[model samples]
Target chain A: MASKLLVDIHTHVYLPRYASLLRSRTSVPFIRSSTSRDGKLDERLLILDHEPSGGRPVGPQYWDRDEKLQFMDKHGIDVSVVSTANPWLDFLPASQASTLAKELNEDLEQYCSDSPILPNAPIKRLYGFGLLPLVPEITTKSLLDTVEQISKLPHLRGLIIGTQGVGKGLDDEALDPVWTAIEAAGLVVFIHPHYGVDNKAWGDKDNGHVLPLALGFPFETTIATTRLILSGVLDRFPSLRLLLAHSGGALPQLSSRLASCIDHDPVVASRLKHDARYYLGKLYLDAVAYGPEELGFASDVIARSGRYQTGASVTGPAVRSLGSQRMLFGTDHPFFPPLNSTEKWKSVVENLDAIDAVQGWTQTDRDGVRGGNAVALFNLVG
Target chain B: MASKLLVDIHTHVYLPRYASLLRSRTSVPFIRSSTSRDGKLDERLLILDHEPSGGRPVGPQYWDRDEKLQFMDKHGIDVSVVSTANPWLDFLPASQASTLAKELNEDLEQYCSDSPILPNAPIKRLYGFGLLPLVPEITTKSLLDTVEQISKLPHLRGLIIGTQGVGKGLDDEALDPVWTAIEAAGLVVFIHPHYGVDNKAWGDKDNGHVLPLALGFPFETTIATTRLILSGVLDRFPSLRLLLAHSGGALPQLSSRLASCIDHDPVVASRLKHDARYYLGKLYLDAVAYGPEELGFASDVIARSGRYQTGASVTGPAVRSLGSQRMLFGTDHPFFPPLNSTEKWKSVVENLDAIDAVQGWTQTDRDGVRGGNAVALFNLVG
Candidate 1:
């Protein structure tokens, strides 16, 4: 049997091309120079409005492949499935979106195909999920063209997309062809959250980006993913291969409740082919949710999803076998850099430790989450 | 040892006075006669604007106490900690709100104390969480007056409240006194979801009440509860016991993610006295989340909360004793009544079976959840 591999499927990166575009812009997704503690000008990524901390500090780790490889080597990560971080062309002018998306996709492919070797590392183990042009007014043909283009990129296993699809949401019927094209190409759709919940929902208080990132991001993912299920997205496109960020963004936990609601609601009962729980195996969840119990709970829920119709009453013990196979280890680095500059990134450390601490997880299960699943799902041979 | 009790803590009802108020109103919370399938006039309770299905059908189960006792007898529920269902007095006029709240509290108390003996039943077992006048116009004096009155009610354990406190939200500082007063009296605050989420989040579609009930209610609960924790409400009122509807409304699942977000964000980290996970034990989550995996997952998360800093690295197995003790059985009766009149409610059966099906759960845990916890939480001594 092959030895266990430590794969980071959820780490993110900004390409030089995208960074250049952001540096020229003055909007929320733009990059600006801010004075640091030492009174030196430092690059900051302002991705949201009224950001209390004046946005996060942006460094080489964000756009530098060397930094990503160094960080991966430092953390013993065998492979990094990189993707474009959020605010991905969503703010671009429609006319420029497709062109920029194509460029960004090429940039990512180039990054993945790079054979750079670090001093202490054996090989450059980097693959990426490309970006999509979801800005309004982009032609469907152009969108499908981008998908076709990304699919042909040998190193690109999948692509990341924000909640907004064709300017509505993932549930929008207009994205049917987009979904079909992606499924046809066998590319895993990484459903990442960028635009959090509405400001009004955040209430009149300013807790900085805590509410938006923590509550807003997951809540957005939950609503969008649910909307897709509720709108029969999964039912219509059975093998769409959707992967949600942030440990399915509360989906694993809320699925039973969502299923119960659907069963009880007359409008949805007839519409859905199966309960929400049945779709748990139909989707993949990135292991970015922090803490051992959190990840363990999510794994258990997804495992239950694999055996939705288990004759538990007669069988006695319930069977759950899908979670580890579907859960891919992710670091979500660059963002959430360590508070102490010299220390290891807490975000990465916490996520890795969480998997290590997960009770009942076998060595094989850990290996599956670490790399085996990503290898199978994304066809990452190396 | 005393025989284990089966208490339903999350069940709901509408008293005579509250029903009359709904009938008199012409808004979302109003009751109106609608033609049914059999060509008979059926009283429909419209709790939201343009609600499809013309609102749920109102019957004896909603407003009649004798029917409640009979339902309890049939279901083998030994005690019930009932509360006024959603949209409770939240829509009343200011001057009338306080008065209506007092009257409703009295009515609930009377319902709980009623000693009706049914055939094959040993006791008239019913306890209740009272109502509060939460309209904007109600003064602090009136709010405290209602709290003071309910605290004095022997049978009323706590009170049910919507996510909206004083029309702003639970995070509103103005409600500090309200939280303090409720805490001071040792009333277990049952935080229920009434006004679902802003419709914008639901998008341009209608799937009946599934969006609101499944996603909206829980989403609302998650946000409101998180806000309370974010605003340091739990830190201020350490002893306050808060019970969240629908198993903490996505709280247990999203909690770890919420904590991760907080740690990443400096503003929240500096502002919050504790991480989001720390509050899991501080708040009580009902097992309204169906499926053993779902309930078990919730219980597991809550149990983790009880021992946050468990030297789990040294301790081979994680200790999780907090969930069952905190998880009180709930029917959510009348709302998700059986679609077919003659059959047992799918809602009730599913919930009960879910408890019975929880993996690794002992008979003691089941009994405790079924009634023992409520018996202790509400001090519902017969």
Candidate 2:
């Protein structure tokens, strides 16, 4: 019956209170009322659209628990590890960021605890990764305290963060306290990229959202994770488990090149003797790659680079160890929504097809990637 | 015993006059002289150095024709279709740019005519791709006139161009005349990236040139080609041939996503009903990917995207009709110099190894990529 163990670690949702908070604001991340040609008032979120034409139609799917359950049931997802969508608490005032983070975490925990709103909804199938208050000027103490608070949330498994950290970047040494705290808390840092590469890179800048979303997002993830690798953050925090969005954002394909560049650089080599390939294994990647070939390649890269042992001859165990447990399924919902369609979301289906087509993948591996791995990794089930 | 038909479509060389011209300036693309600690005068070209530390030591290998023959022989390369390296003539004074380009083209043609300095060097194997002055203020007439003149150079195959055109980008409408002339001349445009994506994308404004070279170069190429695709250039000039560096700079992996974005966009869909995948088969990607797996994936993409027809399906005929003449091989020499060894250049060796690793690639296909394809595509042999 197709395992029926499918888990989506990449899905996103906007809770009711969060939606209300956005509707009350006036700037980015806010919803505004605009009159349609038919003269009806419509609420639009101005996140993507620059003009005053009300942002994309926001509906119950964004905020209502029933809709989330319905979508999961229709997609045959056994479990959905949801997280608040992008621009998450990043715009909140520094003083209010922490308190709001706490409230959101508690509210989300309550939602997960509540009964399934749909009949025949899969049992024990809802969990979430919480958000962090990362606005600039927030005290490191506050950030650390928030981490401490999130660590104790019964349903919170990890923290979702954007590329900008304290407004410098992920490479900033100032972020060491936060990294250390997150590592110490045994929480996975789900690293996603919100701010893409500079807009000038898009050239004459007329392709609309294609450049930023298709290229910018993944490229940003690649650069941020590369900075982390180059800065020796992985070495310092060996236990730091990073979950990269967009399937490690080109990291799997570029890992060899990264290693080659490091090997070729005198300065980089003098400080680090370990292979760059070794660090890739240390990081866990979500299976959000769009196709089976890409998924196979990502899996093969992890298998080859992360193998646990090495011998002198050609025949030897790999030096690092990773298994299907290291991978998780995700659906980058809310974003990449089906355009001009009322049928099933193409984005979700493509991802599901990728899982279906993974070559030589055992039932255990499939199960683990689908739901079992995330369940164990995030403690999704009680 | 090995294929003596080896061709290098990607090789680069800087002419002596051009080197001298750079030596006279103080800005980027100029040469600088400094006193070394040993009190010896050191002359260096600025292209290799970021902070202008007396620039990089310029040697005969960079400017001397005999040295080019020697390197080609040492590396077992039979024929080399060389072009002027990056920052080509994009910075020239408008009045002087076209004239200088004419002179350089003649100089290269004369050099190719008098080659074979090495013992038993292959006959008629050295060819050149001329340079164009693409900076702003240069009239489209001047650009067209230069192309017309170079079109008659027996050894000139095409023009090597950077991303910038008339200070806007490749997508600028002003480039249409230039493209039309080149397409009419049947010259294959070698598209390379010089100015990388903004340096700010690399973060901290420091970390040396690693970020730009390692990340920015490919990112720039990807954006430029995407702009060309998005601007309807392919549809406008279906006959124009383009060779992209760095295996299309992440385009293969992102093509699916690009197609999906276009499929979903109302603006893009309203104008173009064809899938983005259709255009990829028209683009010619060099085999400079750094590894076997990458090469395999690229080759697989070519086959899957219907760029490589094998009599297996309908897409195969379209790919086949495009001709085996479409794809070519290149060595981005002098740029990625061997880091720390006196051994054969690792960059060249790695590329060669990648060519060797692509499984089931026939000798015909192999020879074509090595040199025959470029020879036919550019009409290199007379």
Candidate 3:
């Protein structure tokens, strides 16, 4: 509120060390020299099961800190709490994962601590949410050690994780200590989605990223979050702060239906003290949903979640005021880059415009979402 | 809205003929004898892959015409546009499917033409949305013939279809003729969800029906609708009118994101003439989303979708005046039955209450969603 600061917490990066690791592997999540459609050879990053277009062209923007800074400057983003993007060392061998994750975390920490683009300003332009090595057979001690290390990093604010946890899922009881460690450290857990539902399950795949990124990603987030709720993680680790990508991946709208189903199912009903909607109140979301109507709905759902128990009104005071803080600004940069270089990135412009598009939202609400929220939530000092 | 008639468009019924077919089948979508927890034997309807509790218990409420009438009376619903419940003769053999569909359509027509529960009422108390066989290897002639037959049926206003079309999904190009036939007939295509996402995709199913119904059903709807959009079905069959169950199955909220993703992707963007959000203006949604915030958001998104094209706003008149005729009222009855005998079904109460709970929604908007929209959209006559 004091000054304008646009922070993009949803931005991503792959450190030089991780890029090297990818370059060495031929499997998925690997980078290799491939001839472009126009016959130019470029290093393309193949991190997923994209069919038609093998993958995207990867260059400095993915790993170069200077490029990230340039992108921020271009988009008017003052600070960024970047994370090691998805497929992040999750596939490393069990023996190698822990050590690699340590290296990656350190590498990201180094990236964040680099000379600021605006050293004259009192802001850290590149803080980060570190990554954990969720390998099979990973010990709770190892996980907690990583959490401890991430929290101690001078510029790290939280830990970023995929829907998977310790090879099982976030619902795995084995992840209790990991949740406890992160919660105790008072760091946010950024939950992003990768490995959407089995590609074959969709029947056909001619639509390209439309199926995976559009439907698969959000559905994955929805299922993972629902599983976490059903397994009582929210109840057990009440302090564990989860920041879901894509505006809780359809959770805001589906929360009531989820709660209604739970109350209807005798088995699920006996498990939860509160309805599924109640847990939404405790979760944080990014304003990456790309529409003001969706964002406003997500905000109201969070406020109305504990409707029966909280007795809170969901007018301007609750959803807007509270949401302005909980729903921080984010642009999933380096992913949806503009097709035309001359124009501003649609992803960034749309997200920024979306913050203003929210109906009935005041300037204060806009300020909170634009940067004031990330300032307080991630403790970004200026 | 003229005399305030309360119509329920999302209601369902399992006709005697369909029940007879299920009773004969050993596979899913069957009605069979099962022992209750208290040790009494009862006929249970197993329409889905629900674990722990095999499937919901069913009896007279599921079949008996009088019970449906009584339930309608209890709920104060004036006219009910019933459809054959999900898995509706989908499993019938190709040879039998067409014949059985004809019988079922006739059966439904007879059911609707029966004497009104209230003789003094001018409108038909019961109307029906017919079912298409959509049998495998079926010729286009067969599909159009069925559409023509349904169109002739006096009380049959629309057709209910699951996400799967001819085993390939609604995107299957072979179903083009059927869509054209239905469009030409001016019959609404009620796109409902069944066979949710593959069951194994959810991992261990300790959550009972929570994952499948809450997440699976809607996600299925989302994917199917997205496929339709991506394949340019909306552009090809521009006159095709669709009534999406579960509030367009999260489509309204995700439409902008879908649009953004489409705009970002080369393959998807190349195929579509309109942005993905524009499809919302062309689709009808049910009020089954279960919260005022969700409904308001759905309404807003649909209006905003046409914002660039229509240039009309989305506050009161723009949303309700447009959304009123687009979003209809529905009670997914006999499905989410009340857990107790004394209380009204949580499904009904939650949905009705959701309409009132939407912030800034006017009385006209409420009426539009409640019944007026259904009457206008379905051409339900007096």
As for candidate 1, its clashing pairs are B7-B370, B7-B371
> Which ten contiguous residues of candidate 1 chain B have the minimum total lDDT?
B309-318
Cα lDDT for residue B38, model 1? Answer: 92
lDDT of 1 by residue, A329-382 (tens): 898888877778788888888888887778778877777877778877887664
TM per candidate, chain B: 0.93, 0.89, 0.93
lDDT of 3 by residue, A211-302 (tens): 78887888888889999999999999998889999988888878778888888888888887677778888889999988777777787777
| Residue-level lDDT tens digits of model 1 in B18-92 | 888888878788899767799987898998866877677787789998888778777777778889988888877
Error of 2 at B141 (Å): 1.5
Model 2 chain B scores worst on lDDT over the 10 consecutive residues at: B315-324
Taking all chains together, each candidate's TM-score versus the true structure is 0.94, 0.90, 0.96
Question: What's the TM for chain B in candidate 2?
Answer: 0.89
**Residue A235 accuracy (lDDT) in model 1:** 88
Task: Give the whole-model CA lDDT for all candidates, comma-separated.
Answer: 0.81, 0.72, 0.82
- Proportion of native contacts found in each model? 0.65, 0.29, 0.72
- How big is the positional error of residue A98 in model 1, measured in Å on the Cα after superposition? 0.8
lDDT of 2 by residue, A206-242 (tens): 5657777777778888888888877878878889989
